[model samples]
Every structure is written in structure tokens, then in C-alpha cells.
Target chain A: MTEATHSAPAPSPSGFRLDRSSWAWVGVAPFLLFAVLFLIAPTFFLIIGAFQDADGHFTFRNISNLFQPSIIASYWISIQISAASAITGAIIGFFMAYAVVLGGLPRWLRPTLMTFSGVASNFAGLPLAFAFLATLGRTGLVTVFLVKWFDFNPYAHGFNLLSFWGLTITYLYFQIPLMVLILTPALDGLKKEWREASSILGASPWQYWRYVALPILWPSLLGTTLLLFANSFGAIATAYGLTGSSLNIVTILLYAQIRGDVLHDQNLGYALALGMILITGLSNGGYIWLRARSERWLR
Target chain B: MKTSKIGPWIAFTLGALYFIIPLIATFEFSLRLKRGEYSFEAYRIVLGDPRFQATFGYSTLLALATIVIGVLLVVPTAYWIQLRLPKLRPVVEFITLLPLVIPAIVLVFGYLKMYNSSSLLPLTSSPWSTNLLLTFGYVTLALPYMYRAVDTGLRAIDVRTLTEAAESLGAKWPTILFKVILPNVRSALLSGAFLTFAIVIGEFTMAALLDRPAFGPYLQLIGANRAYEPSALAIIAFFVTWACMGLIQVFGRGARGASPETR
Candidate 1:
């Protein structure tokens, strides 16, 4: 291909400048069209609609209407779920990666865990909810088995598989794996020489981690945690499948608003979606910023 | 070192238990269809049901269409960006990643209102257009993975040199892109296609909202109605996802991060 372009000097650079300049963009026109028509146009319509009144005139009514009790509670619950799941997933996944990379384990374990994480991370949404239901639901296998074996019921201890905590556990199925998938590479970026150098300087293991490893890893750790936060915040199918309309997280609430205008106001639904976009966008933006900062040192 | 080894073993065991127990429970629950005896009756019933066949077939076809559309759109754009329009790479990348930041339900919400019957374009007025809209939605959802894979593939081969070589041979732009560029990125495209297939096959929100007959909604419907079939369906879904991931691992091996040339 390179040779062909070099050899094809039929159209001299000075003669074809006008045509070349215009032709260059033609290659990307289809991509731009698709993005505008599908992605940007739809989101733009919603953002504009969020400020419009029922009669399609500009107004602040919808934005103000987002301060309602039900709507606020929905956002609160969504934040809690995202925070809880992201923190748990980050901690456990970091430890898991740490174990494999620094734990003096077998060589094959890293690839094995990585492959499993790939599957598990994508193994989310509806089937994941069902899997957790089968394992932890009221009449689920482990629930029944626990009753039979230990004469104790998990439900009796307020461990319903469709509540706030239950949803967090379900979200962790994908969240933890995603964390492991991302953090493994970051963890691998940790140099063995740094660890050895720290220990040779009479630094204890805890002191070494606190000084050298933790300082280098905090950016990736925090950035990935923010990413996990946004991931769970946008997720709906698992929660919807597990709890139905019983749990009023923001995603499911927006879903209800979309399906039936359960909010009784069309424009409020637009505002709801706009709010969701803002929250998730902020987290992702933060993730990218932190990653760029951390990668500077790693590079 | 002593505590580090012990810590990893404990973490590995717990992680394995957390990940594996769900599959075991689902499979075990799927078998208790005879009230007292373990059997494959649930799987039999699910496989026999016409609704299952219809929804699964519909989703499979939708997934195939999504893959084709994704490839047709992504391959050329990625190649062009890497070869010609390097300045637009950041803009293209940001747009591709937008779908991830914007939730599927919310994006579909934007679609429902913007293209509804009363809207300007009214994409949902006809069933075929609604299907087209849903396909576009899948493309948007799958854009991140597809673009990343193709871009990575483009980086692996010498894009500018390949384009120049193909041009020097008197080949047209289409031939250069399709014949020369596409084959070099075959494995990456396959990896992306498999990931997109897994995503589209069991997707519930878009299909349900669009009123399409898809496997995801069917599974949810069965879960709401039946007891055991849902678990059976879950197992099947897990199996399909596992196969897709396995294929991705197979095709994507050694093609990620640093290019083969660099290695």
C-alpha cells in the first residue's frame, strides 16, 4: 500500500491540492454521519428538550422539577449502590491482582485469572441477576442448603436478594472482574526493582507498600474505582431483572419514566436522563484525567 | 514473602468460590425440574418452546446484522484515521467512548423521544425502521470495542506504507481498503465481532424498549412466569458468553498492547 501511494504520482501535489484537500474528508464522512444521526443527535435532542417546556418552549421548569422527593431519593440510592459496589469491587479486585502478581504464585495463574475475568466481566446484566437469584434468592440453592445444613435462614437475617445490599452483591459479579481486568495491567507496571530496592533499604513489607508501591499505585487504584462507580451507575438490566420495579435506582427510575412517563411530566424525564449523563460523564472524565496523570510516571 | 504467598492463595480461593458458586447453583437449580428427582426437563421445555426459538433467532439475527454494520462502519473509519486523518483521532475516539459514559437505557430514552411517532424523523413509525434504529443502537453500544479493536489492528500493520503500496499497484481506494487493509486486521475484527455478538445477543433494554422479540426479554419473561426455566436459560446464556469470551481469548492472543513489530 505504501509503495502504491508513493509510485502513484499521476496527480502532482500542486495540481491536486484542491481535490486532495476535499477528498481527504470524504473518507470520514460516513463515520461523522453515523455519529451525528445516532449518537450526538439523540443526546443533543435530549439536552435541548431538558430545557423545553411541554409546549416546546425554553423553560427551567424541568430542571427545577428534578428536586422532587422521589427523584432525589432515586439519585441517592443510585449513588449509594455505585459507591458501595465500586469500593468493594476495587478492594477485592486489587487484592486478587496483588495475590497473583506479587504473591509468589504459579506462572499460569495470571493468564487463567485474566481469561476468567474477561468472561465474568462481560457476564453481567440479566443472566447475572438470575445467577445470583439461583444462588441467594429466598428459595435459592444456597439459601435452601444453608437452612438444611445449619438450621439457619439467610432471609431471617434480613438478607433478601432483591434489596439494596443484594443489588450491590449482584453488581459486584461484573464490577470485581472488570476491576481485576484493568488493575492487573496497572499492577504489572509495578517494577520488581522498586520492591527489591525498598526492601534492601531495610524497609518492612508494610512500610514498602505504604511508601513506594502505594504511592505509585494510588492513581490507578482511584481512577479505576471511579470507573467502576460510573459502570454500576449506568447499569440497569441486572437490577431490573433482580428487583423488578421494587428498587428505585436512577437507571430503573429513568427506565420507568421513559416507558410510561411515570413522572407524569415528559420534560422531567428528559431532565432525568440529562442528569444521568452528567453524573456518569463526570466520573469517566475524572477516570481519564487520573489515568493520564498516573501513566506519566509509569511511562 | 511468606505472608504474600498465603494472602494470594486465600484471595484466589475466595475469588474462585465467588465466581464459581453462582454457576454451580444455577446449573444445580436448573436440574431440579422433577420435584424430587434431578432432570433436564427444564432445559427440554425451554428448548422446545416456540417463543424461545423465536426470540433467540430474532436476537441472533439482530446480532449478525449488528456485527456486519459494525464492521462496515468501523474498519474504514479506523483505517482512514490511522492512515490519513490523524488529527481527527481524538475526536473520533471521544465519540466512540460516549456510549459507555451514556447509559444504554438513557440513550434509548433519547431515541424514544427524538425519533418517536410525533418527532421529525419518526424512526419508530414503521417496524422496519424501528429495527434499523435498534440496529444503530447496538452499533452505538458496540462502537467502543469495535473501534478500539480495529484501531489496534491498524496500528499493528504499517498503514501508510500499505496504502502507498496498494496505490502504487494502480489499485482503487476500495480495493486497497478491502483487499489489503481488512485482511491484516482479521483477527482483531474477529475479536471485536465476538464481543459485539455477546453484547447484542442478550441485550434486554434496547430490544425491550424497542418492542423487539429478543432472548434477553424472553429470559426475563420466563423468570417472571416460570420457576426453573429461568435458571436453565441463565445457564445457556452463560454458556454462550463463555464461548464468545473463549473465542476472543483465542483470536486476540498476542495482538493486544504492543504491536507485533515492536515485540
Candidate 2:
């Protein structure tokens, strides 16, 4: 493709070569302009606002304000949920991906799993919350089934669908599938020769995985876990739809803050957004770095 | 030694159950809206609600507008990057991936602060401008997916040769882009469009914060206020997402089969 483009007929004469080359930048100007105006500028404004006072004076008060108990508690809860969901999602999704790709399952199951994963990963936000509620809420089908058939009530046993654990389980609905979708290809990248070679060296299956496969796959595993963390960390819709404001996740807090200025300080809101950006940004950056490392082996 | 299938089967079964039960429960619950009988009464009420119609229609239009703007922005830029400015690939890709790093709530918060009624742009000053801002936000959210699909599509075709051939035939850039490149990537465009529709249709945060009467906000409102109706809406939303993914698969398969270069 590069050779073809390099050898293509030059539209401009040699005298106008510079002009034509400069004109090429015009083709991308609109895109760059749009990215700057909407994507970069808005976020940049918030990041800058986070460090400013209401009177437009530079101050660290907003950042310091985030250290208060309520704000810190919200961030802590958000981190816990994101980490819990991401870790569990990765484990279950890895098993599922392994089952379909390397578990010697029937051939038809792979496409079915892939297709379902594609749907479920995108099948997030509000409807996902409703689905889980209909499944596990007090009068839900599963709850009723467990009570009628097994003589047990989840509510009586301290299972609440609007709590932290409930939200994690609901999030796994999408997270696990996303894990499956992403990890399948990584699993497929496991060369058959390695397994055969390991076996010929008298290594057991577990030994092979622990010594050979795990080393190559850990970066991807960890990276995707981080990706999932960032994914749920930034998500508001599912949490909002499930627990409403009762959950006190950072996202819900931010949502309420945005809706009514519950924080009563505009700069504090910017600091809240800045904190979210920092967390998601760091996790995503780690994911990218680890993904790059894994790609070297997988490729 | 033959590996035992027990572990894989168990894993698959457990995974399948986890995914399927919620859907089954939602469907069953959606049906139980009426007293002592299974009926589509909830569906009827939801489908017949004037607010539902208005919001769904509004979101559909917004989704279409997002698709159009997204395609217009992404296709040319992707094509240009492939054909002219390959060096800018990394920069463009990084920008596209920024949306994933920055949450929608934060992005919308930024927009409110930057484009508020008192700000320079003041996009939130009017309903029309707010809708435009909302659409632009959707476009930003959909950028990573749309760009990837179109870029992959462009890669499947011989862009340089096609452009040269069109140039020799005295066709202008727009002619070559629309008449030549676009048709070759129709399936990709459709796949991206459907995915965008699925995303923008029931998107809750941006529209809710932007105060647009989108279907997502409507779903949340109904979920907050009503019981059985929310379940019904969940079923409907699932069906929409399923249909979108199914169509993407269909077109995606078609693209793979039809493109001689791929095979």
C-alpha cells in the first residue's frame, strides 16, 4: 500500500509540490478542529477549572476539599466496586474464553459465545440494571423461585439487589462478556507448539500453565483487568439506574452534583471530575502499556 | 491423553446461565404486568405512551444525526490518514481513545462548564444548540468505534490505486470519495451506523445531563417511577441492541465474503 501510494502519479508539477503537500493538511483540519473544540477543549477546561477558585484565582482548595470524609468515602466505594467487578469479571471471562477457545468445546459454541459477548458487552447501562432487578429484586423471578423451591428467601438472608455486591454482580453482566470478547483472541494466540513442547518435557498441564502460559498471558490478563476497572469506574448509568442516589458511588455522587450542585461549590465539582479523569486515565494508561507488552508475545 | 470436557462444559454452562437468566426473568416479568394473566399490556401501554413515542422518536432522529455526522467526520479523516498522512495515525488513534479514558459524566460536566449560558460558546443557551451539543457529544463517544470500522474497511480496499484511477478519469476528490471509496465500504458504514444507533439510542448520561428528552432518559424516568413498565422497556431495549448487533454481524460477514482482497 505504501509503495503504491509513493509511486502514484503526482497531481501537481514540481514547482507546486510544496503547495500540494501543504494542502494535504487541509483534508484533516476539520477533524482536528472538532477534536480540539469538543473532545480536548472541554476536558481541558474542567482540568483547569479544578485548580481554580470561584473568583478565577488559582487555588488548591478544591483538591484539598476532595479529601473530606464523604468525598473520600465515595471515591473509596467506587474504587472497591470497580476493582471487585474487574477482578471477578476477568477471572470468569478468562475461564469462559478458555472454555470456548482451548477447552476442546464443540466448534459451533465459539461463534455463539462471540456473538453473545458482542451483544452483552454493548447491552449495558439502564436496561442492564432493569434486567438484574427483574431477576433478583424482592419479587423477582429468581428470588421467588429460590423461596418457593428451596424454602429460602434471599432478602431474609441479607441479599439486597441495590447494594454494593448487587451492583458488582449486575456489572459483571457486561464486564465478563467484555472480558471474554477481549481475552478470546489472546487465548487463541497461545501457540500449540508450546503445549506440545511442554508436555514432551514431562510437564503437567498445570505446570505448563504456571510456568509457560501464565508468563505470556499475565500482562494481557492484568491489562484487561485494568481496562475493565476504568470501564466500570467511569460508568454512571448502570449504577444510577440500579441504586439511584442510595449507592453513593463516585459516579452517582457526580451525577447528583451535576444535576443540583449538591456540592454547592462549582470548583469542587471540577475537582471531582479531575479526580475521575486521573483515576480512569491512570488505569487506561496502564492497560495500554501492558497491552503493548502482551502484544509483543501474542503477535 | 484425552482432556476431560467436564470443566469446560461446566464453565460454559455457568456462564450461559449467568447471562441468560436475567434476560429470561426480564421477559417473564415484562409479561406479568397484567393481573393474573400473561399479556403484552405493559408493552401496549409503553408503546402507546405519548411521551414514549416523542422520546423514542427524538432519540432515533438524534441517533441518525449522530451517524450522519460521525460518518462524515470519520470517513474522510480515515481515508485521508490512510492515503495521505500515515504519520498522523498514532495521534489520531490516541485522540479517539481519549473518550474511553474520560468518562461520559466528566465529558458532559466539562461541556456544561465550558459551554454554559455564561461561557463563550454558550451552547446550552437554547434547546436547538443544546441538541447540537448533545449530538456532538454522541459523535465524540462513537468516534473510536466508527473510526476503527471505517479504517479497517479502507484497509481492505486499494485506496491509492483507486484514487489514481479516478484521477486519471478526471473525477474530483469528492467524486472519488463518494462514488468510489464509499460504496466499497458500504457494509462497514452500515455496521458502524448500526452500532452508533445502538449506542446513542439508549444512552442515559449525556442526554440526561444535557437535558435532552432522549429514550434513555425516558427509560430511567420510567424505571424510577413505574415497576412493570421498566421491565417491559428493558426487554424492548435488549431487542433493539440485539437487532443492532445481529445486523452488524450480517453486514460484517457480507463484507468479509464480498471483499476479494480479504479472501
Most accurate candidate by DockQ: 2
DockQ of each: 0.60, 0.62
Error of 1 at B215 (Å): 1.4
Predicted candidate 2 versus true structure: per-residue lDDT over B1-263, tens digit per residue: 37899999999999999999999999999999878999999999999999999999999999999999998898888998998889899999999899999999999998998899998899999999999999999999999889888988999999989987887787666677789999988898998999999999999999999999999999999999998999999999999999999999888888889885431
Summing lDDT over every window of 10 consecutive residues in candidate 1 chain A, give the lowest-scoring window: A1-10
Give the DockQ (C-alpha) for candidate 1. 0.60
lDDT digits (tens) for residues A223-267 of candidate 2: 999999999999999988988889999999999999999999989
lDDT of 1 by residue, A1-299 (tens): 33223332444434334555556667777888999988998899999999999999999999999999999999999999999999999999998998888788898998899889989999888889888999999889899999999999989998888998999998999999999998987888888898789888999988988998889889899999999999999999999989999999999998888788898999999999999999999999999899988897676
Interface RMSD of the candidates, in order = 3.2, 3.8
Q: Residue A274: error of model 1 in Å?
A: 0.8
lDDT of 1 by residue, B107-158 (tens): 8888897899998899999999999999999999999999998888888789
- Model 2 CA lDDT for position A83: 100
On a 0 to 100 scale, what is the lDDT of residue B61 in model 2? 99
Q: B116 in model 1: Cα distance from truth in Å?
A: 1.2
